[model samples]
Target: MVTLKHDSHEHELNLTEVDAYMVGKGKCGVCEMQINEASSIYKCLREDCPNNSLSLFFFLHKSCAELPKQITHPHHPQHSLVLGREYNQEIVKLTRGSLPHLTACKLCSRQIDEQMWNYFCKACSYEFLLPTNAYLHIFTFSLCIRCAIMEPAIHHEGHKHHRLTLLRRQLSLICDACGITKENDFCYSCLPCQFWIHSSCAASPATIKLRFHQDDTLHLIYSVPHMYRSFTRHCQICKNEVLKDKWAYFCEDSGYFVHITCARTLLAYGENEIKHEAEEEEEDYAQPHPDLLQFPLPSTDSLVANLLAYHQLKNPSTITNPIAEEPVIQHWSHEHHPLVLSEKSTFKGDADSDDDENDDILICNGCTTPILNQHKYYQCIRCNYFLHISCANHLPIKFPAGKCLADPDHSLNLDKLEIKLGRNLSIAFCHSCHLPTNGFGYRCNSCSKLTDIICCLLPDKIKHDSHKHALVQHFNHPSFKMYQNICTACLAPVLDGFDYRCETCIDVQIHQHCAMLYPKSITHRFDSHTISLLYPPIYYKGIKYCEICELQVNPEAWLYWCRHCDQCFHPNCIRAWHNMKLGDKIFNGGIHRHKLTLVAIDKDRYPQRIHKSLACNQGHDNGSSLDVYLECAGCFFIL
Candidate 1:
């Protein structure tokens, strides 16, 4: 017999060592696990204790009875946590008011009863003097008895190369095994390779037999095979694009791929699924020939043969069949005259001159970009039209149905319009970038949506300087509906359009154009120094305001800042300055405007006028006046 003073109970527990079967069937009070027969257990001999009743008596496994009164957990190393029942009033106050669950273990994410034994950080509950809401940012760490004693390092079957160490704190990262981002949760990590996974994800079975794919078992793989990298594939269960670099379960025979998180739901029903055998050698998959043309070409035999002949001429070593004519192809943009291939400058007066002239900066009609002389381009001698060799060979005449995300039901034909001074400019904005352009684009006849060539060729995955991880393009997938639909760059709501989201960061979702088109650094007119884009958690002395708009800028959101000048500006403000060039005309019918020309004005010079305008604008009352406004170039009037 041993006398022990337990912190949870007032009476002294008289424990006696005996086999669990001798004490009859009972559960351990601390660990709450069944006391197996013949196992050594410390049975409480007290009969009148509150922890005992007529029907049941307090009992503990030998290990549970030997647990220490205090322990130093890795998650909260600052102070020693006390082992006790869930009777901390401070935790009850903090959790009852804000947290959705009554009491949850931070490690296992399981709900614990009030009478259950747990390890809690006592310092967190008594440190604050104010209302619980004010210090809600502080997390009260709590762990169940089972999780508190977990091993610090573990070896998972998924990653056989090295042992994974338990992380002390939760971080914003995606699990490499399951491809899911569970925010603010502890995970196992291999620091060298930056591999991370949830505790549950790390314990996933090596093989699973999904009900949908009954014929063959799906084997876990570290990554998609190299042969399947060229082809885009979606998850067999969720229908979302499967990340090629993340861990997934693959069926080699059927090419069926599923995310680990998506497949784990069916593992409970599948029996005899664990396969300890070595992974079979991957079979060689034949690589498909690369398609040069993204869209369909003209069905006419002559046009098709001419285009194929041009390809053959470009690569003589690859093509054996020879065409007996010069590759003069009829392009869709300039169908009136056949364009002849030219290696040298074709401008009438500058044919022999190698000097770079202003005419050398001729833009291609197909893509609306400058045409370089180094690369071979097809030019029309009868007209001033020119097409790059790549544009002529690959630019599709018309995108097939369901190709465009904006209007999937209809096909979009390639269209181009020249912007002239007198001609009425039908300004069409690219659906992807939302930037106005008169260049060549694919226009849907049914919806009249135009997508620029630059946006149409954007890859499925991109690396941006704003984020540390590669961003995957999403088209309003259901999996992302849990996150806030807002762009991290511009702080604007992401509507029904394409967005690039970082798989690691749960809050990082950027607009397609903002992710791809936004420049990292820009020279703003407001400041002489170059302004670079900045991420969240900006530390400044005072309230930060945009230099251009003179408005408070959210330091938590992305903004452009100049370190030399100690100035910041909103992304939209800088973009507005760049988009609106000097001498640009704006027509506002409400305001008296005979086409207002954009001009920079010094507010300091017209102090009296500003004072008078402010007084007049506020009906003879003192009020703040605008710092910047457009001045009419015609009559020198401020509008």
Candidate 2:
């Protein structure tokens, strides 16, 4: 009797038995793929019979046909049969669709089925959605929910010590990573000189070329250990930590691997161009393999535009027309008050109080803030518009670095800046927002800072956070917009923008209006949570939050995180998104990576009511507030 060892994670099957053996011609009883039938093909007359109880049966020649079989169906207890071809073939044909178990093709990633005639294996009544999918089940595995109603046990051939049993008896198997359950069945053994195959074993196409590695296509082979020995958790295509192992995209060169479902195509349908300067790079002379590392380009249009723009913008010609001229300081009123333009040294009675009359004008045109000598400065001649050099430049700092980009027009070349003082240069950008300005900056001849015009207008009250009640406009308060102050949501300094604020609660205000993307479109993970459109459609019944993304939300927003697990999505997030019921499943392969399990509570919405829960990774400190560190400290700080 052949013992089975399919369930064990270890590969205990010996190398000698798995490879270099062959059997006589026979149709694959499962997928019906023809093998050894041609007269020209060689046949091996081995000792194993076609009807052996082993997961896969074989016959070297017809030696087993003469022997009497002593096998009885284990599950049936009464159905006994001889070891010849007639008895096994009759039993196999009679129980085709009745056999509740099936497996998938390891190569094409298809599933087994019995109900669909078109997909059913014609040779035996074994139904399978993908013909190639059926071939991989070289070792027997249980069929899906539809087929598992009848089979007693699932089996494998190479590993004869352990038995593999399906979880929940689903024809589709769950991948450990990302948790997607599907099928990829072939069980192969590469012995020494010749490869072994059960007469019932079907053939799968030996080569596949994925989109990413279109340049280097690959052929399927069992030579590499990492390719087939064990399951993997990381996505081979993206190098991200999420996916299954059975059905992998194999690189033919060294056999580097990837999960088939996660790998995406990176080929352009049309001719692609590369940016060139005075010369172009020579074409590579080495042969490109189909299964080599392939980086997928963005969509076709994006790739073209990116290539075109990259080349075009490589060298920008200097602007022909000069910027608008700076106005000479003459008669601009400070508020409603009649403020008069004066020389650099002029001040009220304070002029006499200062001993240094030659260069002691400490007044600033922006906010009229007084600056000390240590603050550093630039002085406009006509209006006596002096500025604190440090106050002239600022940047919108995001936590963890690199969320926003510096506007090309606004960012200045620090190497070009002079430190001392003078007006030889013309323009500069704002330090806080990096917007452009020219003429009256706090003139740093050393760093050439405040000699720009736009530095003449830094507003006081602004908003970048969400807590501000009324949209705070430029306030007359000169001391506003200082350090240790930021918008409530993003926590960035409120620059030139209207902010929601209250007089008593200036600390809280949300600016950065663009921060909120289309709120009307939301895809959540929970069935109990409902994402919805606020315009024409009103409130949903009991759903309060999204099921998948797990965001607690209001039902009547512009767009909301809809509660669903399978294929729910926000209209704006996806182009041409269709309205589907809560439990709708999508055939389009987008968002397949998300496990999207549904539950009332998740990490996204912990403590439903602010009660503390212990941290999974980092244990709790005494009275450690879970709410404080629930979300990542960076984004959470904004709210």
Candidate 3:
């Protein structure tokens, strides 16, 4: 194809005619449609063009009929180029394997057909012509995409306060148009003269127009009441179909900035680069062009084709799609849903549903799936997670809540148990872990675990990796307050809600434990016994040596008492005491604190007659609360 130099210094002329070889039939260089439809598609007469394909028009996806026909070429002397067909074949064969010989068009080269060319070669003194072959020689100004998309952009110029750019692009470029770096179509100027712009930059008017080119391209632009933007096809740069809502570009040359983007991206764009970046960034350049015309176009060939396709597809709602049902309030008519109660409610529905469809549907008491199965069913009002009697009976919910439910391991049904003390006096266990749960609660029938009424609202079958079996609340007794001093098994504090629980198997293990829990290794290197708790309140009587804290535990305060070793100790000191299992390694030294060793005492070594201090009454007095206050028992802190 006849091509132009990459230089921005040389202006491009859309040459009118050229010689081209008709190698074969192919898609139109301009429309991308096959040439058999030539009656409908116009052909560019430039030589070197690959059958009137898209590249000749800078890959414009629009119609060739709309393209401007007048243009100017920098290298050629032609001032008025007119559009026309190309050379005949007689001169083409002589230039094979060599550049074609052509003359500059009588009119501007920009107005020439892109697929044909008219040329001249001074060296060979030859002229090539392939007239009937309409698809070969492309226009001299036509550029390949590798060099087409770069845009006219400006930066501070030599004056440091100015900017300049060639209105035309020279080649591919780099910029953060969308903030993406690898490759993005953007506006930029050629490096030296810097005349460049992107399809996007060409679309954005304030960013698009340069002050330097304003005089040549725009007379004035401004907004009239509420009319800040204008969506004119001639000024728009972006290829997206959506029209701008508020902002609009105005140009005096074409009469509108709406086509500004279109004008700039146009290969033969007639304007130059804007001179000031700040001015280019400003929107108040020119006042509204008083003659604003809104043109209404009848649908065209492309629009009709796309619209027809869209209407042919089936609506999504009418099609079959998988439905995922979420859990909701459900109930069984029987014991299965022990807590399920029947109730009526409303529901939210999509627009298509009738007003009556807003009413609630029957749901299962357990899984909560819609249940058309039974006429009468129970529903859990709280969690919305309910089950049918068959399932609920199979699952069994706890009755009364009591201390047993408070245990983490065991569940309880306190309602079955008779209320012993008044509300404050009786400790009801939760149905979850079965430790006697305080306050009101419901328990799962199995697992002997206690659960608070609020906690019960959780989905059935809570699982803990720490527990071997997935736990459920015990449903046997409604309210049972078994122990108060300690959690029966662990002997830890019996806090608010715990389960006084038991596991079934002809054999079972239950231990009262503390509410303040730290993770316990179910398997301990210390013993075959899983570490168990001893309520410190009961274990620390008078003064007891704490296996953990090692200090004598106070008889009153709450502490972690271990049943494994059967000692009350500070919870924090368990590991410390464990570290000192050997009696030889006593932490508190008796040196100043008197390190006591069992040494043989020789009473004979003391003078039998020496009763000097013995003269001072030396005796033991058991009634005083003195600790070393009087080393001589004779005084025994009597005062």
Candidate 4:
């Protein structure tokens, strides 16, 4: 029996049978890769196989064929899983379109390409989509490539009784194994003893190359029982107590013991030796029985690829001709047939009302927003698909040439989105704007992490409608007070990845999407008159206040200010107010005459309505009356 753990869950597997076999063209069932005819192969010979018991048995590479007797996977620690080589008929039958269940490559989060051969576990249906070039480190390591690469378990000499498993969350506790007090969010823990150790301590090497005493080799000491306690014992490096029952490196010949923490600092000092050893090793060959700590650290590119490969299906490539001719008939977001370019308006508009909806209701499917004013748009009559000229003209076929705010050093390229399966969701959302789309954007080359089209194309400086001077694109502010950076427009913490900072003004920062807000003017439900854009440095009375939110507005942030009434509104509040539909009701008010309904103010119909403030029974103790009252049609009272 073999147990494989995935997504913090355990799965049990059984190897029914094995035999020498051959398969042509298709990928191996165990590795999800093409098998070279010249290479040795094996097949499952079980009469009643778990994988559908199909007429044609599943095949595996010689390296992938070997199965362990009984295994306990970190993901599934409760029970052991047995490796099964049979092809799962249940998953194969759904090969017509897509599986009803959303399945991803267990090793990487990348969606399993439909109908492709993969290593599948019957218990969890956890699949592995392997790269054809991947080869085993050695037959000695029984774990699959995915499990081997991701958060692999470690056998430290300090905790010889159990293997310490790598965990992602922070555990604030004194390490039982090392007896060291450290503040790290990530650490390795022994599930059985609840013993935790810092990741750095877990990764400590077997031997330390000392700076002070080069002649002596400091070997790591694992067992430090309470019986070995002595008052005179002290770390040679830190001069601190080498606590009993704590592991440390000791040079017995030199009569010195160094704490594990002290030994880790020597890593930087011994970097030259580390590099020299790595250089001496054969490029393609590794030692058959290398020390647990001796494996070469993965490169930056490899680490990034490990993450990005989870979702990306296609091979990443640069876009040679970015400004290619717009397809006359094509698919932008929809995927039925090619959407033909047409000028006819497909939007159904209200005929009688001269409202803003009549003007801005025609939405572009690409940006998934209303087409403002006379911007030329393309529409498909049959499918009712539409696209803005700007989105259509600048549609990226692949990732674009731009610097990511996340990783500024590496130039990002665009790629088509490979939407994850099992999510009852449509449309790819931009991390910046939070809008749905099917356009191409920049992907981080190192990690394959994606950035939306709108964010990738932002200029270094933007001349926004609300600002007089251009707001510069900046990383986190050096003087940010909160743990997380905040956006000035919404007066909320900027939890999203990046922000646009106004260099001209102090502490003037907004999200990139907020800076690119369109429509210079808008009529908010909170106010009667149309609100105009106002940038930072909004000089006013003692303190400016926003009537919509009834909160104090930061004098140095962009606002939708009305000069006539001296009213101010946060940019986000204005957008939220504009998107609300009529007939909307609110439950809470100062005094409840009726639920506040969203109705147009008709001055002509309600001629006798007084402008004077009304005193409510629910008024505050200070005799404050409800201001700006409106008549509720249902209750026939001021609300």
lDDT winner: 1
State the weakest 10-residue window (summed lDDT) of model 3. Answer: 577-586
Q: Give one clash count per candidate, in the order shown.
A: 0, 96, 211, 13
The reply for model 2, stretches above 4 Å from the true place, is: 1-72, 80-168, 171-174, 182-256, 260-639
**Displacement of the residue 554 alpha carbon in candidate 1, Å:** 1.9
For all predicted structures, in order, the TM-scores are: 0.34, 0.22, 0.22, 0.33
Top TM-score model = 1
Query: What lDDT does model 2 reach?
Result: 0.29
**Model 2 agreement with the true structure over 7-65: per-residue lDDT tens digits:** 11122121112221121123223222222222122122233533333223322212111
> Of the candidates numbered 3 and 4, which has the greater lDDT value?
4
lDDT winner, 2 or 4: 4
lDDT of 4 at 247: 74
lDDT of 1: 0.58
Give the range of the ten consecutive residues with the poorest summed lDDT in model 2.
576-585
Give the Å error, residue 31, model 1: 26
Cα distance off (Å), candidate 1, residue 508:
2.0
> What lDDT tens digits, residue by residue, belong to model 4 across residues 527-607?
679777665434443455566444566544567788788888766444432211223344444446467543323222233
- Candidate 1, residue 438: lDDT: 50
Query: Please, what is the whole-model Cα lDDT of each candidate in the order they appear?
Result: 0.58, 0.29, 0.30, 0.47
